[model samples]
Target: MLKAGDKLPQFEGLNQDGETVRSEQLIGKKLVIFFYPQANTPTCTVEACNLSDNYSKLEKAGFQLLGISGDSVKKQKNFHSKFAFPYDLIADESHEILEKFGVWQEKTTFGKTYMGIVRTTFIFDEKGICERVIEKVTSKTAAEQILEA
Candidate 1:
């Protein structure tokens, strides 16, 4: 996992609309990049909606939010549209961005081990340096966690 002060890796991803979004575009502003396991899951939905609910506050604080998951563009589009989220959701089906950020990992459930994304969030400053890493994310208060961090 990346720690505070580490430089963010250069990455490009496809957003819900199939538009290319590159890390360079976010370099000049504070950014919140969150990795969720999948789209439309209960926990993920709560987390995303919380962020969306508090989006104005986050924007007011100069933070741009991006959500990523191993879902396809069509799935991402549906998720974004269903929730009416104001931010973009990256369709990282290849796990390129997830692996780059080190969120893809071995997870355990019901005594079974499997590879999946560990829900995590990274805060990057204007210069693209990681400022904070939130590994224990509170799904319902994600924006508050970011704002308070």
Candidate 2:
């Protein structure tokens, strides 16, 4: 996983709106890139909605946020619209962005092993250097976690 001081990995992907978003364009912005396993699931929804509710706080802190999951563009669009998220949600259907950020991993659930995303958040500075990483995310207090970090 990327750690403090690591540079943001170059990536290009489609947002919920089907508009293209690229890593290069985020160069001069303090950013938060959150990787969630799936969209609209209970925990994911809580986490996303918490961030959405705190959108103004995050924006006032000079941070631009991006939520990402392995769902398709249509799914992401629905999730975004359902909650009116202020940030972009990247449709990481190819898992390319997930892998680059090292959030994609093997896991075991109910004695079954599978590959999936481990909910994680990366905080980056204006110059794109990673400033912090939150691996054990708290859905209800996700915004506070980012703000306090």
Candidate 1 residue 60 Cα shift, in angstroms, is: 0.5
Q: What RMSD does model 1 have?
A: 0.6
In terms of lDDT, model 1 sits at: 0.96
Looking at model 2, the pairs that clash are: none
Residue 12, model 1: lDDT of 96
TM-score of model 1 vs. true structure: 0.99
Least lDDT summed over 10 consecutive residues: which range in candidate 2?
84-93
Candidate 1: tens digits of C-alpha lDDT, residues 72-144: 9999999999999999999999999999999989999999999999999999999999999999999999999
Give the TM-score of each candidate. 0.99, 0.98
- Local distance difference test, per candidate? 0.96, 0.96
Cα lDDT tens digits for candidate 2, 1-149:
88999999999999999999999999898999999999989999999999999999999999999999999999999999999988999999899999999999999999999999999999999999999999999999999999997
* Residue 2 lDDT in candidate 1: 79
